[model samples]
Target: MDPAVARNLKRRVAAALHRQISDEQRATATDPDQAGLRQRGRALIEEEVARWSEDYSLAHGVPPTREQDRALAEAVYDLLFRAGRLQPYLDDPEVENIVANGCDDVWISRADEPLRRVPPIAESDDELVELLQDLARRHGGGERLLSTAHPTLALRLEGGMRLQALMAVTPRPYVAIRRHRVASATLGDMVRLGAVDATLAAFLAACIRARKNVMVTGTQGVGKTSLLRALAAEIPPHERIGTLETEYELWLHELGRLHQVVPMEAREGNGERGPDGRAAGEISIGDLIPHALRMTLNRIIVGEVRSSEVVPMLRVMTNGEGGSMCTLHARTPHMIVDRIAELCLEYGPRMTDALAYRLTANALDFVVHLTMVDETGVGGRRHRFVSHVLEVAGLGEGGRPAMNEVFAPRDGEPRGVPRTPPSCLDDLRRAGFDPRLLDSPHGSWSAPLQLQVDGRGPGRRPDPHANGREGGAR
Candidate 1:
């Protein structure tokens, strides 16, 4: 087929589909009738395409090829059911993340591949903005807008993908679609993925069963949430679990093992100021914490602690029932005290550094630090693994957290030796876990830590600067 002819056909089909969609929207204006309206619109588009094809055949005295017809149909479908050019990437299960910079630039990261450029998702900046707006309106339950006034859009899509867009605030629209690949996972799955070894997996499961308060720490995009979700799966099937988040990231309610799951998401204000110049209708995680407590939750899971909410989260961890879990951003487990103290101090005036450190020490039991490491041989793809596991003993002499490094890999290896005895070994034993497992000087790894890309062993000492450690292993 001629390129000119194909382009013309595509334009015509897309135009017809767009017109049909508009007519359907208007016809169902107040009532919506989304399903019926979409059905009617698709039927109209097929009718129009059939008429156009017949007219072209009669005029040219030849039928279009199957390829041309298929192209025309796909063009119409793109305007109808799909999100224009982004539908293909969204359909791919392997795609882990999709990033769009304006309309012309698109990039995607796959589960098994590194970041790579992809075809444009929109023809122009305006089209890109419109697409994002449509996505927020359709999938986000019409709770958001992407305009100069709002200037931002954040929501979850129909396929459980999280979409965030920064528009008008930046030079061009920036959008990211984060796919939750580990929606339904278990501790065994983490072991299979090399995120943790079987020994650590068993230990984590025991901790969960023992109802230990756990916090997962890692740098951004290091799979902290993934590990948190896997740990959540370790909870017994009978216990009720509640999760609170800024966004609905932990899909624990969807897990099969858990029968009772209450999930709450924080909401951004409507960007409107009231008579007293106060933000209206804003709901924070702190606000939700008190409400979640009323539900008689067996455990509370805060998605990520980044603000004043740490105050309530800490109170719940210490004063409330055990088995609470949350994730926070920290480079290593040892830095958790300072990070929590900083967040509390930065977000609230009443919170003092002394109080923050005291609360963290009394409340949190364990911290698992996740990091991304390059694989040695097979392929050098960056893999996220559990690098360190530290037990929060108590406040030290200087008010810093006294951590027992239960697991620390030398040279970025996935496996590590157990440095300190678990504080909750008795609890773990009562929960039907083998207490002898904690006695092992070497961790559950059958072999030694050998995946270090630098060819370094556990005998190699870590860089002093990597973590803010003063003297040898406090």
Candidate 2:
């Protein structure tokens, strides 16, 4: 089908369906449920498409084919209730990220593949902006605005994807969509994916069972969020848990194993300012943490600690139940402490460097750092694995936190190996961890990770035995 014709038909059918739904709601005096609404929408789409086919046949003496009609109706439905052209990409299990710089410039990053350009999502720049506006209005509960006055948009999509868009301040509207590939993963699942070995997986599960405060640190595009989700899966199902985030990402509430989950997302405010000189209705993650504490949660899991939220998050780890967890952005395990201190000094005006270090050392029990090896430029697949697990002991020299290297990459290997026993090994043992696993310096990996770097040149074929697991979650 021609792109132009498809776009026109989709727009027409979507508009008609919207009007029909509105009329039905007014007549019934009650809105339908989501399943009922979709059923009605699809029925309306079929009727409209049949009518259009009849009219076209009368005008041109040839009706559209059945396949074309079916395709057209599905497209129209997507435009009305889904992500339009982007819905198919989102539905693809292998697609990891989507980037759109304009209507015609789009890029897709998939598992084990180099970045590739894709077809346009919209017919024009204005249409792309309109599409984003429609998405914001539909998914953001009518509270998000995307116009010249408020040109930035951030929200979670239907299946836990995080989307960020920019307009009016850049050359063109830009969008980045990141998918949570392993939203429901557990430690056993992580082991199957080669993200962690069996021994490490058992250790991590024990850490959660022992009620330790853990912080996952990694750079962007690594698997910090996924690891956090897997760690959360170790918590007892009967325990009540609260999750706070700037946007909904971890999605711990969706896991069936967790019985009691309180999920909270921070809200952006209207453009107007209040008497306090802040956005009128803005709600920060920091604001939600204290409120979560008052809810009698057994544990609090923060999505990410990037700003002043670190202040409250550390406090939660200290004052709340001991199993509190969160993620942070850091290049290496050694940099985790410095990163937390920097965020505290920058976002918390009253916080000094010494105070930040003290709080972090006192509140955090362990730091799990993930590493990504992107060899796509050299004809190799991207590999992500846990490379380091640092145990925060206490305040050391120069008022910095002392750390014990529980697990570390050894001899240029990208995967972590057990190095030192944690100071609280007794607690882990009580939680069912085997101390003998730490006796093996190589951990539990069955084989070394095969890579393209063993004397292989750029564009050389990857070894067949190389690990081909899919990349990690957002």
Candidate 3:
């Protein structure tokens, strides 16, 4: 009823409301009493607004009870700091990705199968933009709409998080956040999610520790990054690691390195960073690969080797100066090597067939093929997320690339685990694993019923119990 009292009420409600909004945006908890205060304060503002509207209507000789002007002012202030800005699941440790299809739809995926659609917390498009901008700033640099240029731009947040946002014309804007803290994921964590079992886990550890060059191939979001992160965790603590990525995605920096993770980011052009903060001059990742040679690093990691970077990466692998590891987007490990060969013709014209084969066999000591399989072979699979870890044996007579069925659960059933290829086991043995060592409790190659028969068709499953034939723990 009183104008002065209404003014005080508006100011108090706005301040408390703004603070509550800030807490929510930062993923922090707010006080319950604060909410109650906001409600009571708003009621006081509404009464004042009504008086203001009535007086104006009388002055204008119009009958009016609604305070449209005061209502507008209060609405602006209240909406500015709403709880719509907060996204708790984005910061959740279990959530791997946050996908949004415009302001109306949002979804999240965990390592385990379960894609859940979320309810819209934003009341309007402007509210959505406010929240997204705040998120961007907290992660690092915030996002904005460019009227002169493209209205959309994706970015990598500090500590290698991923963020994408789009400006809107009518409907709400779209935003998706992918937060991966490049930390070395533990094998136990992978096992818990069924990404890889114990036997394959041990084999992968040995492969990395032995300085074997490995190519991990998989489709996008098929846990390719997860598998890569898990393997990066396996890199020996004593060695130096150099990693190059389009955008820094690997967390190898925290691990051992004569130890350096040289992360190469993509510029506006199809090249890498320059000495300057801007992307004028393009520094190729292929060129950066050679720098690892001068660093005396034991292991070189390329976050994901694309076209031209592949050959140079392999060259370093074959030169005997370093072990190469990178993730590539592909359905199978066989396709990974093939793609590299095609890339070689593009990057390494001097490479011959024989030389390429020798170099490939020499450079790539192993290929860990990772693929996601649905739970139901036919349909109706709900919790249908499982990663199949396959290993590469070597070049077959096919002259293309050959893969050994190293790790796949039979009928997709969780059996004992999959056994390591005898080749890997033999290599481990020659490095001094006694034949009897496997029978000993803690032996690296020791595991029972882990290798299940494929029985899908005609195939030979290596007998880890027999002598090291294609058959031995020999």
Candidate 4:
């Protein structure tokens, strides 16, 4: 069926359904349940589609096929209750990113596959804007707005996908959706996916168990959030945790594995300024961090330390509980100290480079950096791996924090291998990390990673030592 025809039919049916529901609600004097509303909408969709099919048969001497009718109804239903034209892509488990430049230009990025263009989700730029506005009103507590005055929208969708949309500030309205493929992953799952070897996984799990404040750092789309989820999974189930984010990406509260999880998301304000010269009604991660501390959380996790949030987040790690964790954006492990200092400087006039470095040295125990190699342009796959893990020792020369490269990339290998023993090796041992596992320079990987460009299939080999056995001092 033609996309235009399907879109027209969807619009017509959606309008009719809206009217029908409104009239019913006015007659009943009460709102219908979601299931009841859906039932009525589906029935109306079938009736309208069947009538359209009959009229088209008489007009063109060929009726729309049964499959086309079914497709039309589903599309109408999606427009009414779901993500509309974008729902199919969101349903695809392998899809990692969705980018829309205006109404007709759409691109999709799937796991291990090259980027590809897809059909338009909206009929025009105006329609696309309307779709986004509707979505913002539906999700994220309906407080977000997208308009000429607002110009931008950022929120987490129903399936934990992060969405950012822009209008008025760009040549055309643009939107990007980032999907989390491994939202509920564990350290073992990371090993199976070849993100980390068995030895490195064991070491990271021990770090979590030993109540070390750690940070995961990497560039965009490098699996930093996924690795953070895996690390948080290492915490005992009974402990209470508080997660703070601009949007609900970590979704620890929904995991059901933790006994108690307090998930807090920051809110953007209305387009007016307050008496303090800040946006009216706006709430920031920095505001939420201290409030979370007062909640008596066993551990606090910030989804990402982007800017001013670094000040309070670092203080939490330094003075709060022992097992706090967060993610940061940095190019390399060695740059993490400088990055934190830079963020602190950006926060206000009070913070200095010396104070930032001092706070970092006392706050953080480990820095795990991830790296990604994208070869999809050459008919190869994208590989993301842990490349470095730096252990913070103390304040070093030149007002910077000193770091020991406990795990660094070996020659010709993207994954990290055990290098210098961590200064806190004894603490890791007490938390059940096997010191002998670090003896193997290969880090327990049975074979080197294979790539499609090397004329070999990118098949992951199982870790030889990935049995049920726990690694520790025993």
Instruction: Find the candidate with the highest lDDT and give its number.
Output: 4
* Cand. 1 TM to true fold: 0.84
TM-score of each: 0.84, 0.92, 0.60, 0.90
Clashing residue pairs, candidate 2? none
Better of 1 and 2 by lDDT: 2
lDDT of 1 by residue, 1-474 (tens): 232343344456547656766786699765546676567556765666677678889999998776776666665555555566787788899898899888878999887677789877766788788777666666543366678988988888766778889987899999998887877778898887777877788888988888889999999778888889899988888888899987787888876678999989887777798896545787889899999999999999999998889889989999877999999999866677888998888656787888888898999898888987655234556677788888889888888778888888753445555667777778878887776665665555444433335456444445544544233321
Quote the lDDT for 114 in model 1: 73
**lDDT (Cα atoms) of all candidates against the true structure:** 0.77, 0.86, 0.56, 0.87
Give a tens-digit lDDT track for model 2, residues 1-474.
Answer: 455655676677667767877898899988767787788778877887788789879999988899988888877788777888888899998999999998899999999898899999988888888878878887743368889989999988888898999999999999999987887888998998889999999999999999999999999989888889999999999999999887878878876889899999888889888997668889888889889988989999998887878988898888876999999999988788889998888665689999999999999999999999888887878889999999999999999999999999875456899999999999999999999999987787766666777444544334324554233321
TM-score between model 3 and native: 0.60
Q: Cα lDDT for residue 29, model 1?
A: 65
Q: How many steric overlaps does candidate 3 have? A: 4
Q: Which ten residues in a row have the lowest lDDT in candidate 3?
A: 139-148
Candidate 3 ranges with C-alpha deviation above 4 Å? 1-86, 110-113, 119-154, 158-160, 164-175, 179-183, 255-279, 282-284, 342-359, 375-395, 408-420, 430-474
> Which whole-number lDDT from 0 to 100 does residue 275 have in model 2?
90
Give the per-residue lDDT of model 3 (tens digit) for 186-291: 6666665555545556666666666677777777656556667777777656666677765556656654432445545443332333576434454557767777
Write model 4 residue lDDT over 1-474, tens digit each, in one string.
Answer: 555665576677668877887898799978777788778778877887788889989999998888988888888777766788999999998999999999899999999887799998898898889888878877754479999999999988879999999999998999999998998989998998888999999999999999999999999999999999999999999999999989998888998889899999999898898788888889999989889988989999999999989989888988976989999999977678889999999888988999988999999999999988888987777888898999999988886888898888764456898999999999999999999999977687666565545433455433424643333320
